[model samples]
Target: MSTARVWAPRPATVAVQIDGVRHPMTPGEGGWWEGPDLPPGARYGFLLDDDPTPRPDPRGRRLPDGVHGLSQAALPRLAPLDWPGRELRDGVIYELHVGTFTPEGTLDAAVARLGHLVDLGIDFVELLPVNAFNGTHNWGYDGVAWFAVHEAYGGPDAYAGFVAACHARGLGVIQDVVYNHLGPSGNYLPLYGPYLRDQAANTWGQEVELSHAEVRRYILDNARMWFEEYGVDGLRLDAVHALRDTSDEHILRTLSRETDDLSRRLERPLTLIAESDLNDPVMFRPRHEGGHGLTAQWSDDYHHAAHVALTGETAGYYADFEPLTALGRVATRGFFHAGTWSTFRERTHGVPLDDDVEAWRLVTCLQNHDQIGNRAAGDRLSASLSPRRQAIGAVLAVLTPSTPMLFMGEEWGASTPWQFFTSHPEPDLGRATAEGRFAEFEKMGWNRDVVPDPQDPATFQRSKLAWDELAHEPHRRLLAQYRDLIALRSREPDLRSPRLGDLSAEIDEHERHVTFVRGRIRIRLNLGDATWRPEGEEEALFATSDDVSGNPLMLPPDSALVSRTIE
Candidate 1:
């Protein structure tokens, strides 16, 4: 016999609809409803008030049919894993969507591709959120059930199998989790306790109630459950800036302390990486320092500066960063807007990283999900830049002082676009997304008619990785270069050092040339239309283009050259 409990704070009466029969539930204190002697495979949904529609359990452990049908109490086959001893800062990470990572579009299939990643020299595999969303296909941000792995991705058992496989291969698995808000469809959290804030709002609708004690407990408990039960090495917190909690002790701090305690008990490394737009150094500072003790956070300034410098497209946030000097600042200081004015916000923002903080506290990337997918056409760097330039970007990313991360297929410079796509079963949800997407682009002066409907099936299919591209000539060369660069980063002492002062960047804005110096290694790039010859004596190490020659080096347009300074 199994028992089920759900929190319906506002409901006057709650009943469990099981096999065409309604079983009245006992309402416990604090708006919780409980039922005893329920079967494991029982088909039950909560009936609130006079409403005809039955809602799935808000804290459903398993969703058998996507997010629309029965909530099963089915026990997961594999027990939660015990985390292996490993530090996130010590390894390179490769982020991928399980559905698009392989042709099979399942966790088991993704396991088959782990050898390829291991061969590529990546230490951690950061998966997009696997939580149950509204449909069969999505970017995974619109997650409804935070606990249950999506049924489309082989359910809870398959997820355990995938994690176990990764551990066996000596690779750490990082799961992306969404705590800011839930999706529109199948979002029964509001019907429950104070899971959502009726007063507060985020860019994506209602915000999670982190200030409330019970709500705070729920969120913290969920985070700990994944680490303690699932053996997850680390969590990539999605859009942390949107998590509004005015409590004296922020929820992030609480999570950091809990995770730290768990890590000590398990005798393994556990990390928390936050996806934050706020460039506040407090996120990386230790809890004892009167700051939130997150391990690392995404550095958008690095991407914005690097992208604008390479692509020369200064639209949107790129407007704030047109010159190479901004990129230089990020290279040396770890933040471009360090107490400086932000042109985008028209306000002073971001605190500079403390002198004691290492560069690994920041994670930099050229093409992340938001950077690539939010584009009007989802065009990747390969779509805009030539193969040589793409290689240059990769070298710059890996050689930087901060920890580097690569999106799937970016190593080979795959030409396929990863556009925003979803397969919401509800017609209302589909329509809402279509209208909302167009409206968003309209503010940026984009043609609304030209924007592809995210609800379209073709949109999702187009985002899948083209595994065949890996075998192609140009792609193969780029892939080899990436492996070599990662290998070099791992072997070179100076490259792995996260010291901020050990890095410097020399830039000629008019010539469109930038040279980054990290210890004995100096990497120079010609972003202009003309080739440049080096002034001092330097031995050539690597060049994206083959045009450079002689002791005084010459770099071709949209190319990069790396050399070691001769004494």
Candidate 2:
């Protein structure tokens, strides 16, 4: 018999409603209530004591209707994943939002574009959140139903197909999941039990009740669902620092251990990458060594330093990273702010990464969703910088020791802005979101007038990548440069070497020039107006501009060249 169970101890009595029929549930141990089992395709909800309203299952796998509507039981599980799993090694990741990656904004439509990613030589296709939320369209951070795939994105089957499609194309899929906090709307967990801490709140909203055993299990189960059912290669844990746990054994440690166990049983690499603001190397350290044992973590310091060096915009958190030396330090040491004073936070921040740690454990990017979408105008570097300057950023991103990631359309230098957009059905929530967006950038001296209203449909449309732009002049040229750089990265052994100690950078602040030495290969970039010649006897492997040729080597302004020693 299929047993329908829910952990809702707060209600003295509970009932399971199926297709308009209410069946009484018997209370069980561990604050659980059980009733008759639900068959496939059954639309069900849990009815608490005295309240006529029915609440969707906290672990519901399907939500055909919106978040507020009844939960529909999912179809029978699909056949076992037929292919051998892949690993995250010296490879590139391409991050894209499913809603804006294509015009159709569905998983099937995204499948059609897998060939482009394969052509670009990306190893993993990292997707933004696809979970169910209240509205029609969003950035996917406002996801309320963690278990259900957003219906607008073609639901569970579509999600499964997308992962399988990526695998068929020799690409691993990394699904970004948020476990720190729930969204602002359609959250009904509190009505069933103490699923959320009352007084505790993070920047997003009420924090998950990590201290509660059942609540912790709820999260672990959700993670397992993605691995076992959806067959994703890895998970990108969003804002993991926000998950505050005072327990002796942290949830992350528990997750790491369990995931490792599953990895062994499945005989495949199950990667867990965290996006943490903590800048702590412990996240990727081995658990036996008193660390969390994640596969990798996003190194925002690299992005900040690279952005500042390329753009010379030192507003907000970019203040400390204004110097070109910042880029050199980050490229060599893996973290620029390791135990350094932060003028923005008004305090010293970050512990230095151990020299033994591999550089590939830290993912570096020139542009990503947060760095672009958080801006007041949602402008990309392509929107402002010359194509040659943008090419230097690409050289830094791909040729560095660390694992690299590229945002959608960044390779082609698409001019479309990836603005902050949402479709909150509640009018008050929509207004609050728009006002909050303005307030966030105001401190950075950004013009609030140019910031598009997040509630506007036009904002979301504006963010879609114009695939046609790939055929144009600067766009086509930039795309070719990216392809060559990525191909060169894969072809060269030294580029994939992860030893942080072996990496070195030379920066001339006055000349606006930087040279990165990876083993015997040297990458020279000229960000200044005047052409600069660096003494070197090497063969040019690739150059962003034809002007990068000479006896010694003359790199044009805002141009870059990759060369190797003749030895």
TM-score list, all predictions: 0.94, 0.98
> Which residues of candidate 1, in runs, are more than 4 Å off?
12-29, 37-42, 47-54, 76-83, 536-540, 548-554
lDDT score at residue 227, model 1, on the 0-100 scale: 75
Q: Write the per-residue lDDT of candidate 1 for residues 337-417, one digit (tens) a residue.
A: 989899999999999776677899899988888899999888899988878788888887777778899999999999889
Ten-residue segment with the worst summed lDDT in candidate 2?
A: 74-83
Best candidate according to lDDT: 2
Q: What overall lDDT goes with each candidate model?
A: 0.84, 0.89
lDDT per residue for candidate 2 within 1-567, as digits (tens), equals: 246789998989999999889999999999999899888889999999998988888888888988988888765453255657777778799999999999999999999999999999899999999989989899999888899999999999899989988988999989999999888998888888888899989999999999999999988988888888888889999999999999898899999999999888777789999999888998998999999999999999999999998898998899999999999999999998889999988989998987778899999999999999988888999988888888888898788789899999999998999999999999999999999988877766777888899999999999999999989989999888889999999999988956888888899999999989988888888988898987756789989888886356888788898998887
Show model 2 residue runs off by greater than 4 Å.
75-79
